[model samples]
Target: MPPKPGVIPLGPLRLGDIFNGAFATVGRHAKQLFGVGAAVYGGALAVVAATIAIAYAATADHLDRIFALSGDEDPRSEDWVPLLVAFCAIVLVCLVAAAISTAMMYAAVPVVLQEAVLGRPTTFSAVWQRAWTRVPAVIGTVFLTWVIAMVPILLAWAGVVALVIGVVSMDGGDGVSVTLVVIGILGALATAPLAVWLWVKFSLAPSAVVFENQGPVAALRRSSLLVRGDWWRIFGISLLAGAVAGTASYLIQLPFSFIGMFSGALGSANLSDDPNPTSVIVAMSGYALAMVIGQLVSQLIVATFPPLVTGLLYVDRRIRTEDLGPVLAEAAAVPPQYTG
Candidate 1:
């Protein structure tokens, strides 16, 4: 009912308002959102690619030996060690790159939203610089939240593993594995709700980090305050946003996957029975490129939309609990050039 100046009414918002605001933010700031996202993720991808290339170069001999092994001739330690080390190194590099990229995007969204809420325009350079400044704090918040949420998932995995072991060792009369399975299952079930609760409670931390310029722990405590009393509403909306983003990402990637599959099949049809590495690379290049493009697109959606929703939720909570609407409206009335 309030004056609609920006993405949402400068007041407490409903579920529809939050969702629409998120979409509006993306539409208005696509250049900054997608542009910075592409730069960050593209740079990460390049780093990962460089790492893989270097690793492959170093372990090329071991890889050749691996491929040279006959049907029944198992590889020796020398044949596996170099490749294993390279694989572990590559994995470590990937994880580091992904963490940094994700943290940057998370920081960037709230920066964009800060302007979006006030109907002010922002640029890619502004978002990029501000986001980069906050990346370390965002990384801390994201890592802590992830560790909290993963508790239930890890417990469930342990339960599954214990169940598998129990089934495999059923002939042993001690029944110890059965007891372990039961304990794991119960422990996982008991902790799952706690994990979900903690996750939602801290969901607004990244936004707080950027909006309030708070450190990770302070931002988390701030999120706990804002999300206090409205846990279910925040939880449901967050869940819906995540589901929507995930589905869209998957749908967007489907066509690329099909194209890659068909093109790879066609290309491989021309390969000889004992084709060399060059030929194999050429044949599979289309598939690799398509998959890469698909993954990039998917990552863009995953990185952008949910954070937008969460950022809006952070604004909504402030409007509701802290009476932030008039402040936002006042900001919206100012010319973009006049205000910082």
Candidate 2:
């Protein structure tokens, strides 16, 4: 039986449905969506790498001093100012990368969703052309989210530090460590609920930003509305998405990690119970390889999943609100324009 227009419930959704739908959508529109996603990921990564390289070049002296390299260091103690400026510069670059990626994903979602609903190829260029206009909205949403997310992260870090200090300052005698461990566990428990809430709230923010051309607060509000009365469903779906993506990422990066671990072990052997320059270089090389592998995995995972779910949700919302059957039919022949 065909589902009636505006009768399908989007909110208070089932976790299994969302997860299965996301996967099905990905399978259905794998080629074009994946192509665009990969392009976005590549572009964003290149920009981010360039930004980091610029930052490193700008503050090489400060970084060298921070590492305590024994050489003719800068005489000024205020080299930290350069480091701070470089950090900010890198952050700004990251923000720009995020906004660009989000915009591309926004464009990709409508195309993927349309294709999934009515099995066909979408014009990548047209989708991208429309997406360019929505860049301002995407940037605004990213900016707002960036500002809001920092608050909780900072608070969480501060709490962690306080917990560590509290544990260390306690008496070390006779099961005191156990007591402190319990307290630390309790603190983590306290933070877990906040983390979960934040996750649900912001999970759909990207969609809102992409679709609504909204500022951060408005985008968050829209997400909250969409997610209302269905937090567990969204949360469960999120966990499933994360698990699948994480497994895929781990599998992809496993070889790299193994190589890094092997090199690290070799480096440790070279230490001879005393670190030397060769050992340091070997260790740093392994560490750098691990980091590079991690970044690659992260990019691949991000490129793979977010668009799938966002596209599905956009369709789900349309099915719930508008008479999406005809729209989707038209979208089948002509790719749907991202209304947001």
Candidate 3:
């Protein structure tokens, strides 16, 4: 052990040290971490809600026309086109909001960790400002990593689709579908390990982008260098962190889900036989709001804790490989105001 200045010992860390440090980082800086997360994600939800509302308003006439069509009647292109355009616009806005929110959280975690590792306090504004500046680079890293991970996931889904097609075609005696299914399954299996390996290898890129002030590609290379010899360790730790975060998120959201379910049931029970559309909408609004709040809370946990774990892993990797412990120790010895 070198020194105990902060969340973790100022030395190469073990598994316990990394997890403890992650939890400690949250405990010490909950205000900054959760505050930024809430603001970013909450703002994203608000933006998405606004987009959906605007889209609905713009296409209200088209929707009404479509709904009014009789069983034998088909909607005109004009009736459907506006709805389709609005749907696409809403999807585009949602994707942009999700990407930006994810980037902010990724950047914010490392910004907090940078000080947490040195036993220093950070404020929400400081974290937000630092994270906002790094969002573009973090977005690049996150997008690249998502693309890399999606390869095998898409392959697996293709396999499932092929399997379904093969089963459907069995009645028609098509051997080609069977062959396609086999090939898809094999391809997915072959690519799955490579995807996992690449994911772990580049897991630290977002942290590197923030901590080292590196570009996305440079941060990726830096992460690969740091994770090269310790792939299994990092993979296992990341897997565990993801499991913990997912389980905790699910538990946290359960209450809201139950509340939504019960409220929706109650509202439905209270509805008259001839309830109007407006009455139905009002009845379901409570359920929709509850579910939205639950999802927001779930997303908050999923976005925050895993990044904190990964950020600390980034620090642990540096201390282990580059002897960064002494440098961090030295920084920790300085008084905060004087250093600032």
lDDT winner among the candidates? 1
Model 1 clashing residue pairs (backbone): none
lDDT of 2 by residue, 154-208 (tens): 5665665675567567744546655655665676667667766775766676666
Model 1 Cα lDDT, one tens digit per residue, 117-176: 888888887888889999999999988888978788697867668676766777644466
Task: Mark the regions of model 2 whose C-alpha exceeds 4 Å error after superposition.
Answer: 3-17, 51-88, 142-195, 198-202, 208-218, 261-294, 321-340
TM-scores for all candidates: the values are: 0.91, 0.64, 0.90
lDDT of 2: 0.63
- The CA lDDT of each predicted structure is 0.90, 0.63, 0.88
CA deviation > 4 Å runs, candidate 1: 152-174, 276-278, 337-340
Estimate the TM-score for candidate 1: 0.91
Which lDDT tens digits does candidate 3 get at residues 1-340?
4798889998888989989999999899999888998999999999998998888778877887787788999999999999899999989999999999989999999998988888988788888998999999999988888787778769686766867676776663557666667777787878888888889989999999999999988998899999989999999999999999999999988999999999899889889986655578689888999999998888888998889899989998999899998999999988654221
**10 residues in a row with least lDDT, candidate 2:** 4-13
**Better structure of 1 and 2 per TM-score:** 1
